[model samples]
Target: MSGSPPAGSQQQGAVPNPGSPGPSSPTAGNSGSSVLVHVAGAVVHPGVVELPSGSRVYQAIAAAGGELPEAAADAVNLAAVLQDGEQLFIRTKDQAAAVPGPGAQSGAAGAAGPPPGGAVIGPTAGTIVDLNTAGLAELMTLPRVGPVLAQRILDFRRQHGTFATAQELDAVDGIGPKLLASLLPLLRV
Candidate 1:
């Protein structure tokens, strides 16, 4: 046991060496990283929350201190896997009536889906990405936009300011009229 720590015990006053990498250190090949999600609307504490990747929507809501008494939690599929930079909007009961919950009928009376930046469907499935708030990864989910185009869009936002409408994407390099048209249906400002 020479110079070795005693079984399940350490020398008194001994401290961990800061320069050394521990087994649980982030640099130790840990792939279970966290994702940042914006939990807004009707939650007790609405804001950006950092949760482990692959965390479910319910977990994000829990992180945000759970839903408010008026929150229509049933409107959102809590089991849905969350994506980084995604926004989870919890609508109130009144709001849910206008924007039909999960399996609610969508005829002349009920709207087909939530309004722009409203309730999110699955991760990047039917969610309308907000041009002013989207990050690189979320922007890449749009049609005809890869890493480079996404970066260009981000750069444009940084340079010019928030886009007033989806049509303003035409100002970004490589986003022609046709591409903008294709993305219009999926994007909002």
Candidate 2:
């Protein structure tokens, strides 16, 4: 027993905590919280991936089976943090060039679709957001809507039931004329 370690204790830092998630675990970070991101475009696999919360864009790309040879990987800010229900689209080199960068001209709201080359990263940018069924994450995708407003909308729906008309959203607390008008085109009852 001279050279043996204590029976109840192991070498310091040598034994991992059994209760903790290992590096290989899907929930290694963010305390077991995870987010689903839809990675589309030039990746080898285009689909949704479940990543630990606070995962970066590059992780999403890797989760989608890595970028294709033709993917304009440089166009993506790989260090950007991923959000739940987010869509991370990788465009081809040619497509990347076609899509304007920040400060570029965007058509009137809801008048035109997202720019070519998958420049838009929102999950509901050009898609219809069903007010009655939309969740907090989906509602947050709308312009000018944040966690508080999104929750308010949900509370309103639960209290008053399904929205009969798109305009009905204005009745929700904090949803003023300007906000309602801005969200009208992107919302559907």
Candidate 3:
């Protein structure tokens, strides 16, 4: 017999041919590793984006067609790692001012507790309340949210876990789209 090995057998240290996929190739195991994320606000295309498993916030934004001209880039942590099924809300400069400072939880981290001082600074130095964890008193600070409506919000929260998104406020009896739109800038999930 000749010294050479069989024709179809791989040599000990030889590189695999590029045309054929190998067992360790990226394409071999990447099919189900994609993460689905919802990117909204301040992005040119505000909707769901599919990205690789280890994608970052910046990549998600790019998948959503990049940020809008009015986006508050400074407010976002572009390097933050993305999680599947998370919603990324990019605020505008005006909207960014309404959000609480650095310690506030965002994205898939779950609902943030009330601000330390019970308020966050808005664009004009006014205070904005967090809907997910705000007490009835804090809720009353919102436009048109009086004692009764505030209590209703509290009741709703007690009945159904945390507010996953500000849009959930619509489930509260008295809140509507117009009010939700106004509240959007002054609230956090």
Query: Whose TM-score is greatest here?
Result: 2
Please say which candidate is ahead in lDDT: 2 or 3. Answer: 2
C-alpha root-mean-square deviation, each candidate: 13.5, 12.4, 16.1
lDDT string for model 1 (20-107, tens) is 3222222112344666777777766677766656767776676666677887776565665676777777776666665422232111
Instruction: Tell me the tens digit of each residue's lDDT in model 3 across 110-180.
Output: 34332322221112225455677665434544555544576788899989989998889889887778777
Model-by-model lDDT, in order? 0.59, 0.59, 0.55
Tens-place lDDT digits, model 2, residues 19-98:
44333334434455777677777776677766677777766666565677887777555665676775676767776675
| lDDT of prediction 3 | 0.55
Shift of residue 22 alpha carbon in model 2, Å: 10
Off by over 4 Å in 1: 1-32, 100-128, 131-186
Tell me the deviation in Å of residue 84 in model 1.
0.7
Could you arrange the candidates by TM-score from highest to lowest?
A: 2, 1, 3
Cα-based lDDT at residue 175, candidate 2: 75
Q: What ranges in model 2 sit over 4 Å off?
A: 1-30, 104-189
In order of lDDT, best first, we have 2, 1, 3
**lDDT (0-100) at residue 94 of candidate 2?**
76
